[model samples]
Target: MTMSEGDLAVTELAFVRREQIAPLPPPAMTTGPLAWVRDNLLSSILNVILTVVMTALAVWVIYEILDFLIFTAVWSGADREACLASPAQPVVGACWPFVKERAAYFVYGSYPIPERWRVDIFFAMLATGIVWLLWLNAPRRDIGAFYFFVIVPIVSYILLTGWPLIGLEAVDTALWGGVLVTIVVAWAGIVVSLPVGIVLALGRRSRMTTVRTLSVIFIEFVRGVPLITVLFMASVMLPLFVPDQWSPDKLLRALVGIALFASAYMAEVVRAGLAAIPKGQFEGAQAVGLGYWQMMRFIVLPQALKITIPNIVNTYIGLFKDTTLVFIVGIFDLLKTVEVSRIDPKWATPVTSTTGYAVAAIFYFVFCYGMSCYARATEARLARSERR
Candidate 1:
């Protein structure tokens, strides 16, 4: 409709703004760190009270821990007297001196001092392979995988146990102890478990009845029992069934048991990841003419494994700590060494056991926390890549 002459005359007298209004800044309460604090910690009166109480408690606990670990700790000297409270030092905290004295024993245990260099070499090789594999941008990652999953284990075996052909002395597994044994048990379990778990997970889902049945039986049987029982059976009962000459080393048995136990748990984690995948994924892969193995490997397994990284890492962390259980079989792991050291009459003091346990706690925390951090980083990286 055309504007009437009278309307036009009135519109001409009215003023109209010609430019867009500038946008206002976001509200002050919604845009800063203080906003986060307020929203999360002080959103309600009850939350405010809880936050203050928790913060104060945290600070107090931290202060107490630092005091026990550092402020009153004994740093040097020989024997129990060094850690004992005296007139000169009226209070004692951690017995750093005790840890200092037994540091070598804690690392090498009964492994011969001169031959301990072999263990050091193994550690270096293991670290090299791990860094090579885990460094996403590193060159020749396939070779890194080979180095980590294949060469390292073989060379490590020869290096740690010795080889006559290589002019190395044979060090019995009985002599393996301390951090050496602990890392060995954990590394073996971690390395073997994942691939075995994948196969078991696949078998559990297989169309073949016999394969599925066997997989289910193995997984259920292992999961039904405690790890300590597995350790005992492997370390003690297995030898009874095998020929005397065919019997495995005690450490070997425990390693097998640990690997089996972890694989069972890992299989369940993998299966959960697999179940989370939609049927469309399987159908789409087949629609593209992919074979069963190719579909699983390229189209399915990667997604499944990635989905379960957190659970996989959780199982690994538990297995790492579970290495301490080998002590029940007379294997001297890191904790076992600490246990042995605390009982030494020379260093016996009120604080000796506490200090030893504190060291063990720190060791476990550092490694487990490192694994957790790495897993989180991997998850974040994967999420970023997917978003792009």
Candidate 2:
């Protein structure tokens, strides 16, 4: 259609001007604690109700625990009678006096009074070495690692068992029990299993048929059996394989069983991590002319191990807790020590058993929680490094 000449004439252009750009604040509803409450606790009607219920329940539980553990608990007493409720003291709580009285026995078991200092020294040195290794800013981390991985274990063993060549009186392994034995078994399993697991994992993925087959068989066989069965076999059946004149210490046998059992599980965890690495990583290493071990060491393993830190720590925690199973083999670990201590007629109160177990639980929790926290920190650090 054509526009008529009379319809409309020339038009003038219109323009609008801005004085300044304004900055806007974030929504008040999406900041601070109130925002967290809105997003997490009160996101929906059901969430609000659940959060309220859980919070109230947690508060009640915490209060009850504190009341039992502290408010009405007897801290000073000689025996069970003092821990019990009487006309003079109607309130009854945890028999902490029993724990305090037998603290040494719980720690060192029957490992003679005079030799206790050796255990103490060993703990001090171990703590020092750990502090040095984990200090972050501490000097000579390589030296600290060497001391921990090499010298500390040797010195610790010598100190704990005593070196007659060095004029120190020997302590019998039979006398070792309680937390001392538990730490030994757990630490040994943790330290020994990692390398064994790595080797098994590598073998499982090896190019050679025999190596792969043997690795698979061992891993499957061990993983198929319950830990208790392995422990029983180590304690009972292992002696038959050795010469009559060559008897292995029961503790050593238990350590072997625990280490082997842990290694199988650890190998699976490591294998998962190795599998997660892209094939390109391996190809890249090969393209750079790196040999198998060298490629794994400098390229593959560091990444794989970092990825597996959480699983590795979980394995360590499981091994630590399983040390309690040594009780079945007549080795007095922390749990066994507590059990034995609670049976004493002198301290046998209604609360003694619970108190003893609570103490052991606290010890286990602290160690496990520490490992978990360390794993989180390490993961975060590695993530940040990768981002950079």
Candidate 3:
């Protein structure tokens, strides 16, 4: 098998094994991150144009926003005296000092000045519980559940609306306003509506004709009417529905209306998720001999609810914002608080529009944006898990 000197060897066979240096290949660009940007972001002529336009638009928007918030209004240079100056000679900028002066009102509303510490404690507990829940991989999972379902609610409720057992003075819901009212209404709506929504969704999917019909009628009836009308009915008609001897609190009445309205929308959202699930999943549950509740609790709902998380989050955001509509029912929420502040004789001026609106905008942005971010993160995590 020796190849004497017979073959000069084909192509570069000899050199292949030799330590001979070959010419380096010409450098070629790769479609890595940079190339990805060039393609998707700047691929076609139209895309390139769009990119340029968007970049310009973004820069222009930033410039204008900064100019308004910083330079033109002299927000950075405004002193305390300048800020608290009469509304007549307004700075035309954000009345941040006004917000600062009434920050307590914004947070706890007219809750007793001495009891504001309770608000602080409630917030601290809420924040801690939320953080604990987020750290689900911790060994304190069971503890976390207890804190969430039991401790947190009890603590928050007691702190917000005191208790005779704790020797604390009770604060009436009627005195609640500002962000406290917002939080109360939003949280109550979320808690109450979710279970109701689940029931309604189940009813809509039930085999029983009467239950299904009832669900459909309820959903359609609520969905067809505007929230304004629902609020009106709650304010005017809810009392009549109950016995005169058992009059519901105005806040409770509004809560019922909100819960009912929110549940109808949430039911639709959940129904969409339920519909997306395959029929085989149900049959599989049946084949396994899982009872209806067990099948739904373990098998069907987990998957359906996961699919519906985005929709459900959207519904939640809608409900949170819609709680503002309780103002129409004479229930003071965050928006209503601002509305009240705008009418203050001292603060009522041309700038009142700007100040009240700016404050409300900031609050709304915080809640809505936080919800959106949470949904995005949840969606991303679910996507990654699916991949794995």
Candidate 4:
């Protein structure tokens, strides 16, 4: 169609100029570190005030901690005298020398110095197994699980307590104290509670009336009582019910008590996870003609456990810390060993108790923090796999 003269003039006037149509960069207010700072820390006046206040408080805390832990700390000393300042001087810091000297007692307890290599070897094996299990893309995980679940426990028991048939001197359970006892109790509780808890959780969901009732009763009863009561019952009252000829070791009693207590709590965590699973999952498994156990094994539990990883780890951390309560039943754990060391006249300085506690706190923090990190990593991995 031919255009009128007026329309043609208007079209020519509306034509774009190429030089005036260049690409433009993002706004300065929406890019780079400065932009991020503005959007986050300085987004509002209140945020800016909070950020500055928090930063200053953090700096002050860090400086104070570093000053106390490092600046005036005594690195090497012979005894209480070395840790103390002369009348002419004032001192305030950790007596690290006592920690250094008593390190073996804290780690091995009364474990014989000659047999300490066994503990070292067991720890090495534990580290290897944990690394293998937790490492992403690791090989032969099945073999690693077998070694961890079966061979390691058996071999570790023999090594730690010795084997007469193998011509090794036996170490009494009474001599087991400090971190050695703590680890043993905590690990046993963790390993035993998981399977037991799973069973209880399954039982709680069972169609059988008796099974569900019993599971409820047990879970409620155990969960209702304090852990200290459980420990006392296991240590004191449990012996009365058994035959006089059959005596259980103190460590065994503590382990059983801890395992049972932990299992009760763990069962609830597992049950919550199970409840979160959609009914469609169970129905889907049933649609394929899968039996009850088969459906749970293949579909329900895997999903449930993945969902409950955080809660499971939390329970485990609590159980690990609870191992310290064994001290009430006359079993010396890490904290108990520290307390015992503090009473020793040789190392009795004003700072001895605080320093010992600090050491114990560091040990506990390292282990608990590792577990937390593993939980986070596992959760991230599972989330990625689900996205895929």
Candidate 5:
């Protein structure tokens, strides 16, 4: 029964430590930016190839864009001659002079120069309302909401179209063109789409047979048709329903078409978000003695809308871009203005069309990208709040 000294020595060597060991630094290859690069960029041969190829492609694209936008772009001149390539001038990218000369036309699109101040005031008021409403923590948000939802549209009509009774001579909607027209169409679509879409979404889910059926019919009919069809019908066919003199403004008709089309798409986006919400949410709201409308207004709808923020913003961006389609019906939005100006004998050059389109592209990109970024930030903020 006696153990040998060699056996006791082996048992002593295998003893466990009682105290905790201090943590050691991770290996250099697995702990720093190098580690991140290793794991994400070069973890495999395929990944390494993809990373390298994509990086080079991005660099080339960026360089080409900069070269066209800045390096070779014409900065100033008096006429078309400024943009034309010469033996001395060599390469020319954008025709800045053309854009500069026709800047007013691009923005106002033959809106009476004498009355353009009204458009300016309209812009100022719109900017004010948008800033106030979008500032998140802005003071007097209720007032901002009132100004945006109520006062702006009403006042904008009277201010821009003019109230002759108030000494402001009537500036016909026919004179509305360019940025003014684009903004009008987009603003109407974005503002009108959300509330209308919410209604349609709720209707689709409602137990009432008539409301649900009507909502389904409308959403399907609108979604089933192209925006062009709606616009054409609005601008051309709708007038047939009324006497010639009583027909609505062409711009107004287009506005209605765009709003309706956008609302239909928005309804689907919202419905998807609503579907994602658990039935427990509805039950919980009801259990708290909240009426259907109150439960939706205070609980369900907010969560649904928040979840669908990206989709909603995406729809807004599409509607914004689709404003260009108004030109088919003789309504001159920003793109139409660009189309008209590019053919002018005074500023026309090889680059004129390219330049005009470039400006429109930049404008659309800025606005769309802004909306996207705002939506992303909103999503992040909501996520943080939920985590808290």
Candidate 6:
């Protein structure tokens, strides 16, 4: 029964070791969503406070949006008289009825009611072509080449100009108004500006001093001037430059101005892409015995353009929105359509401001959103191929 000091010492050491080796407190409970959240949002008092503030702000925004859109609209709609109460006492929610009434005009402009099917067919073909282009795994270059080089121009011109080889009546350009005009201007600008931009960018970097100097002067000069001034020049000064008997259509003049302005901007964007390319790319081209044009077409430009597609798309989006400024030159684009709508005596209620603004906002949102989505898809496709 009696134990030695040695025995007691051994027993005490054994107990200490057991305590130290007790599974290490279950490894501190790592590797779960809760742990991740705690690490990210609740790790410190400051983080917790930030999280709470953001959540509250988000909830408040959602509640306000719901109340304004759903609740207010429901209240106003329950009493039809309340919606049309007065220009001063108009419903606080959206005037969707105004949109419903004039949406066709917004879509097709002043294109004849009887021949609206032409616009429909044109849009359908364009949509199909776009869908094919956006399918990254598809035979893009071939399909897109057809869409770009052949189909698009023919379909768009026929629908817009209505030169009517197919029993459809001709629609005068003068009568065109609304979102169609916006699209017409943007599309024309995009197509015309791209080739012009490519040339200008190449010229700016060309070995020929004359070409380089001229490109620099033109790009900088156009970019330096405001779009409004360009539109003004297209409308006013362009006539003076032309033969006295040769007056171009107003829409054509606006298109030329928009294309020129957009091309200048596009050239700068392309030039930035060109400059970002490594000198070694050019050297590699030469090492391959490729000539200047071949080197640019095959090696340098492909890589440079891949890097700049996102930037190019952004520039296009800006150009698309800027098409609205053609209104300054008396061209009726989407925004101008809204401006014109307000002058209608029947629709010219005190509510015209809200209605017109709401329509324009939606039109812009649709187009700009589409362009942004296209840019994202293009970026994703490029990323998958290990290109920026």
Best by TM-score: 1
**Models ranked on TM-score:** 1, 2, 5, 4, 3, 6
For residues 1-388, write the lDDT of model 5, one tens digit per residue: 9999999999889978899999999999988999999999999999999999999999999888788778899998888888889998898888887878788987888789998999999999999999999999999999999999899999998988888888998887887788889998999999999999999999999999999999999999999999999999999999999999999888888999999999999999999989999999999999989999999999888888998898889999999999999999999889999998899898878888988998999989999999999999889988999999
Instruction: List pairs with backbone clashes in candidate 6.
Output: none
lDDT of 4 by residue, 201-304 (tens): 99999999999999999999999999999999999998999986786987898899999999999999999999999999999999999999899899999999
Best by lDDT: 1
TM-score of every candidate relative to the true structure: 0.93, 0.92, 0.84, 0.90, 0.91, 0.81
Instruction: Tell me model 3's lDDT, rounded to 2 decimals.
Output: 0.79
lDDT of 6 at 56: 99
Estimate, for each residue in 1-388, the C-alpha lDDT of model 6 and write its tens digit: 9899999899778843345545554444475777788899899999999999999999999887565445544232322333455667454555455556667877777778887777777667766776676666777568686886588878778776776568657888877878778877887888788779989999999999999999999999999999999999989898989896797889989998999999999898888889999999999889989999999899988887888898898888889888888888887777877777667655544555566776687678887898899888777877887853
Over the full model, what C-alpha lDDT does candidate 2 score relative to the true structure? 0.91
Off by over 4 Å in 1: 1-25
- The clash numbers for all candidates, in the given order, read 0, 0, 0, 0, 0, 0
Model 6: weakest 10-residue lDDT segment is: 73-82
Clashing pairs in 4: none
Candidate 1, residue 76: Cα displacement in angstroms equals 1.4
Clash pairs (backbone) in predicted model 1: none
lDDT of 6: 0.79
Give me the displacement of residue 140 in model 6, in angstroms. 6.3
Clashing pairs in 3: none
C-alpha lDDT of candidate 1 relative to the true structure: 0.95
Model 2 CA deviation exceeding 4 Å by range: 1-25
Q: State residue 274's C-alpha deviation in candidate 5, in Å.
A: 1.7
Question: Local error of candidate 4 at 78, Å?
Answer: 0.6
RMSD of each: 3.7, 5.7, 4.2, 3.7, 4.8, 6.5
Q: After superposition, how far is residue 206 of candidate 4 from its true place, in Å?
A: 0.4
Question: Candidate order by lDDT, highest to lowest?
Answer: 1, 5, 4, 2, 3, 6
Instruction: Give residue 282's error in model 1 in angstroms.
Output: 0.4
